[model samples]
Target: MGQIYDLAIIGGGVNGCGIARDAVGRGNSVFLCEMNDLASGTSSWSTKLIHGGLRYLEYYDFKLVRHALLEREVLWQIAPHIIRPLRFVLPHHAGLRPAWLLRLGLFLYDYIGGRKLLPPTRTLDLTRDETGKPLAPGRFKRGFEYSDCSVDDARLVVLTARDAADRGADIRTRTRATEIRQADGMWQVTVQDTATGDRSTISARTLVNAGGPWVENVLAVGAGVNAKAKVRLVQGSHIVVPKLYNHDRAYIFQNADGRIVFAIPYQDDFTLIGTTDIDYDGDPADVKISTDEINYLCKSVSEYLARPVLAEDVVWTYSGVRPLYDDGANEAKAATRDYVFELDLPGGLPLLSIYGGKITTYRRLAEEALQKLAPYLKGTKAKEGWTADAALPGGDFDVSAVDALIAELLRDYPFLTPAHANRLAHAYGTRAAKMLGTAKSPADLGQAFGATLTEREVRYLMANEWAVRAEDIVWRRSKLGLRLSKDEIAVLDQWLQANRAQPANPMREAGARS
Candidate 1:
């Protein structure tokens, strides 16, 4: 027998990382293994909104909405740099749901979670409001504005993993928990390091199957359980294109089919539009954004925009599946985003399975997961909901007070352009200091990789976060790939080849949290 843990997490997406952080903070030994990079799965391919999902309100999921909205403020407070409040403009159109219903929805949304930080909704005369300048004038008249939050979903997952590590949790990326079996009322889990092809066994009293799209498959195949819950995997895809508008405001469009889509401002020069929901089967790892999805998304957005968008306009695309709790909704869009916890527990050892979850609801999801496992663990009060006050890594600044901090950071780093400084602050929050390291000048920051990406930033990623591949730095850590060229990407790949560290030895047990 090697090291024993209180928790062994099967996935390294946001939910897994969030749970690991929660368990570690509760003074439990934890080991987490992700087969690929963190957020390499569905967690990164999100529409990237941290909101109550306004549409869910139509379904009358008041409980889910309240929890998600409350978590939104909590997350924004913890990582103000990464998660920030956003305003959405819904343009009133003819032949759609009545304005009275829309007003009622927005009114309830404001009051859903005891609104505090976010401004309340307002009616907008689209013809006069600045939010309607780009719209085709006669096609729209009135509109509504509401609050939500946007996030760098991948970085959020990584930061939670980082905090868990800082608190003494053992995290392994590019490692797969290949198999799990029960013996003596404890779990004997085998994990394989993909890079080295070495395997090691870990023991845990609890095994959390937090796999997102692969949750059911993991329960049935990997964890060797014949029984499982009702879950449906629905694939959702997002497409990024050149910025269509020049405002901080995002547009929430209602489709002809009564489905809604978002056209949100992204990465300074791009707008992120998405999410076509379709049933998916087969391996979650091999899921891809298809041409049909491209057409559907383009057509849907084109119907509402002044200048119609086409497939050729897309610069980047991402797709992933949502593990929705099977609520018997035949329509893919109608499936629930709320999560359900199922236990494959045997002999009092716990195997908790998580179904669907929105980015806004991860913290409460962790709390509930622990509550379900409370009886088995025998320490019900060890770590009871402390995330509200704690900041993740560099996110200690006031969420509303970020403008002043960004202004100060800009003054301190005169070499950084105003826009670049804001980008760094948003990506790393207060941790931008760590990314800068001791580089006193632009030259000292190492070779400029591309866009604002520098060698120093790369080194910082490798040293602190598990940034092993070029995509890890580009696509997830920062959206610099949207700005970098093929040549710049090649250089980072070459640099990683020469400098990337080997996966930590499975034989060598972790000594500290980080």
Candidate 2:
């Protein structure tokens, strides 16, 4: 007889990691496995906004909107390092949504969410405001600005997993849950390490299938539940291009097709514009931004911007399949973003499956999920809403103090550029110092892998954050991929593979030896 976990989760996305953190915090032993890397799926492919889905108001989903809106501040407070307030400038289109209607939606958006720190909505005079300069001349007269938050979506998941691991939860990446069964009053899960081809079986008192887009496949194939899938796969895509405007504000443009598009400032040197809502029926892993999607997004933004966005200007494009709960909506765009749970207890063993949740509401979803499973988890702590206040790893400082943190980094490391210090401050927060670790010069940080990424930082990611490959380092850990050449990336990949077996603290050891 082996130790049976209180919870076993089969997903490394936001929901699964979040639940793992909350469950373990509540005194339940937890184990979580991801098929590839953390946030490697739909979680990282979001529009990267923590918003209330204001358009959902038209669909009469006030509850979902309100829940998401309320969560915006809570998420910002806990992970201020990766999340910050962003102002969206919505230009009034005479041919599309009327100004009065937009005002009404903005009003509901401002009041329903218990907004405290975020600025209130204000009217923008496009004729005079700098935000209007990007739009075609004399085409629009009025606009409105409202508050939302932009996030480093991938970092959020990784940090959550890191926190869960710190709290005694067993977190494993590159692991797959192949088969699930019940025996001896415990749910048994057979997991395989994708890297080594080794298999092992573990027992848990309860199981969770937070597989996102693959939730159905896990239930029908892996768990053999013989139930119809309730997930609706919707493909949303985004394209990144050179920075469109000089200002910090983002734009939300209304199209003739009743869809909304956003052009947000991305990575300091580029602008991110995206997101189409079309139903998809293919493997979630195969989802990609199609030619049609790219053309459509470019045209959608071009309708408003003075400088037309063409396909040739796009530097990168990515897509993800949102596993929305199949609420029987006629159009994919109308599908609900609210989460739904299906709990099955066969032979007194519990298995819970989750469907359709957005990043903004993941914490609330986790809290509610634990509440539903409370009866099954004995002696769990009564910290129902602890996550709302607890800061994630490296995010313990005040949100307003980001500039101060950046200044401190530059003062401590005079060898660092302002841009490099800013990136480090946001990505690692107060813990940036831990990676720098008494370095006096750029050489002390080791080889520069381009774009301010150094050997010391890469080793820190591998040692603490489960970064295994170059893609994990350049793409997920940070977006240095945009700056690093292909040859540079390959060099990094080779270096990581060759040094895979080295000690996690090799840099510190080398420094001490000197």
Candidate 3:
């Protein structure tokens, strides 16, 4: 017998981490386990936008649209470092959706979800606008510019988990929940550390299955719940290419097939164009960008841009499986982005299984999950919607002050390049100084990996952010993978392996023991 937690979350995606943060903030003891690194799955593979799904409006998903639309500013305010408002250029195609319908959609998009800080929708003359320069000449005359926010999606997950850990929730990465069973009115979850081959059992009054694409697998295989899956695994793929245009704005182009693709600015040097929606039946872990998906993305964006994007132009491609709630839509693109929950109180224990949700709606989904489990979470303060006002770690400053913060970092760290200062300001917010730790020169930061990554930053990620492998630091913790050469990455990986004895954060240390 062991200490029974108030909540046990099985997943480390955005939804799971968000729920853990919310639950722990309400004074409930929580334990969260992820089979791999946080956000290594679908969460990191998003189009990187915090937006009201404008396309969902055509499917009459007004509720989801409004809910997501409202979260835009909320997320931006809380995490201005990793999340900020990004204007998008929507060039109207004469052969596709009508202009009147586009206007109606944009109107709904602006008003719905209690939009406050973001600018309202306005028409654009693409012929004169600089945004049109990248498009084919004389083809797109008029367009619309609207407000949405781009996010470092992986950072969002990591920070949420970090906040939860700071607030006393146990977050275990590289830990798998192998089996779940009900005993003595408690749900006992048997977990294993994937890295060390160690096992333990944790008991909880309530359990959450936030497995994303593996939601059904968790229930059927881990808990032996035999119910049919309520999820539809839809694969979405994206490709990264060299910067398409010099402008900062993103583009949302509509195709003849009624599917829309986004070409968003990424990492200051690449255009992230994606994502194609197709039915996926393979293992979620094995999902990868197919040749057709690559060709489709290239053709779709090429249809609007002056310079055609060929497969040769693709620098990288990634794909993820979205576990959409099975709504029986004819096409994957038409599936509902809204989430659904299945609560099973078998023998007086609460087990909540989540299916299908977008990044923008994860907070709301977490709040609702708490509401459903409120009865079981006794003696907990259960403060409702406190997360709305609470800022994640290092995100305490005002949203409008990002540039000021960057300048402040440059002033404090005179040796840092302007680009380095900007990256630190955006990645760590006010905590950048803490990571730098009074270092007066590059030597104080220890060995410098390519792409401005340093041994000091690497240690900070491992100790504070649960970053273990080189991929965790380069790909998930930061997009330095794009810049670090293979040799540099190998060296970093070797260094990490050699330095595994560095002190981990208190929560991580505790997680290892548990």
TM-score of each model, in listed order: 0.95, 0.97, 0.97
- With a 3 Å backbone cut-off (N, CA, C), the pairs that clash in candidate 3 are none
On residues 1-514, what C-alpha lDDT tens digit does candidate 3 reach at each position?
8788999999999999999999999999999999999999999999999999899999999999999998999999999999989999999999989899999999999987788898988899998889999999999999999999999999999999999998999999999988899888888999999989999999998999999998987886557465454899999999999999999999999999999999999999999999999999989999989999999999999999999999999988889999999989999999999999988876767889998999998999999999999998974795576898888877989999999999998888899999999998999998787788768899988899999999888878888999989999998899999899999999999999999887434323224211
Predicted structure 3, TM vs. truth: 0.97
Better of 1 and 3 by lDDT: 3
Each model's lDDT: 0.84, 0.91, 0.91
lDDT of 2 by residue, 345-454 (tens): 76777778999999999999999999889889874778575799999988989989999999999999999999999999999898887778888999998888888999
TM-score of 1: 0.95
Which is the better candidate, 1 or 2, if ranked by lDDT? 2
Q: Rank the candidates by lDDT, best first.
A: 3, 2, 1
